[model samples]
Target: MAKTLKSAAVFLLFFILILLTNYETNNMVVEAALCKKRSATYPWASCVPLVNDNSCETHCKNKEAAVSGFCDTIELRQGFIDITTCYCQFNC
Candidate 1:
């Protein structure tokens, strides 16, 4: 009976060690990726025909210290003359 108890104790310890290792590894991976990529958008009120996409990207990089940026234009009015509004996406 004593030998059986010793074997059970060893098995229990090994199982607990495995559980703790798995839990820590999963927790660390989650923490690492929690903020891996984040993004934000802002209105570009000064957007005009002369403004280029590269300029918008550069502006976002400067303003938000972003890794990259893109300009998305949407036309509120659809007619012979369209009114376009520019929105900038910043990715970090």
Candidate 2:
């Protein structure tokens, strides 16, 4: 009976260790994704209501963008309102 109790206690301690290790690993992976870094050709964008691609690129440049950007738009109300954005690509 004493040997059986010792074996059970060992099994419980090993199970707890496995659970704690798995939890720590998952936490690290999530934190890393949120603070992602890019060494080359990283992109940062600014959004605005725009009329033309050249205009958008020029706008991004004024905001310290490394390269002139292109226009990307999102439709809000089918054909009534749209949001135009510029994405500038550059090195990190």
Candidate 3:
């Protein structure tokens, strides 16, 4: 009976260690970006020329990880400007 109890205790300790490791891994992923790329600024808005500047900000706030978002414009060609790209910023 003592031997059996010892075995059970060892198993319990191993299981707890596994649980703690898993939790750490999960936190690491969340702290980083979804693809393991940690960036304060990210383009994360609906790409549309007519989108409002602050529209992306709202979208970023909706994300569980995103702290904020902004809109930016890019010039593709002469007199051609593309607008409506929201850059999302995470707390991490």
Model 1: which ten-residue window has the lowest total lDDT?
A: 83-92
Q: Give model 3 RMSD, 1 decimal.
A: 6.8
Runs in model 2 deviating more than 4 A are 36-72, 84-92
TM-score of 1: 0.45
Q: TM-score per candidate, in order? A: 0.45, 0.44, 0.41
- Tell me the number of clashing residue pairs for each predicted model: 0, 0, 1
Candidate 1 regions exceeding 4 Å error are 38-92
Q: After superposition, how far is residue 75 of candidate 1 from its true place, in Å?
A: 10
Assess each prediction's global lDDT (C-alpha) against the native: 0.62, 0.59, 0.64
Task: Please tell me which predicted candidate would have the highest lDDT against the true structure.
Answer: 3
Please write out the lDDT profile of model 1 over residues 13-86, one tens digit for every residue: 99999999999999978866754534565555434436444465666677767665655555566655544433
Which residue pairs in candidate 3 have backbone atoms (N, alpha carbon, C) closer than 3 angstroms, thus clashing?
44-86
Tens digits of per-residue lDDT for model 3 on 7-79?
Answer: 9999999999999999999988776756434334445345343543545666678753577666667667768
- What pairs collide in candidate 1? none
lDDT of 2 by residue, 1-92 (tens): 99999999999999999999999999888767643431122122334334333454565566545455565677989999976555554433
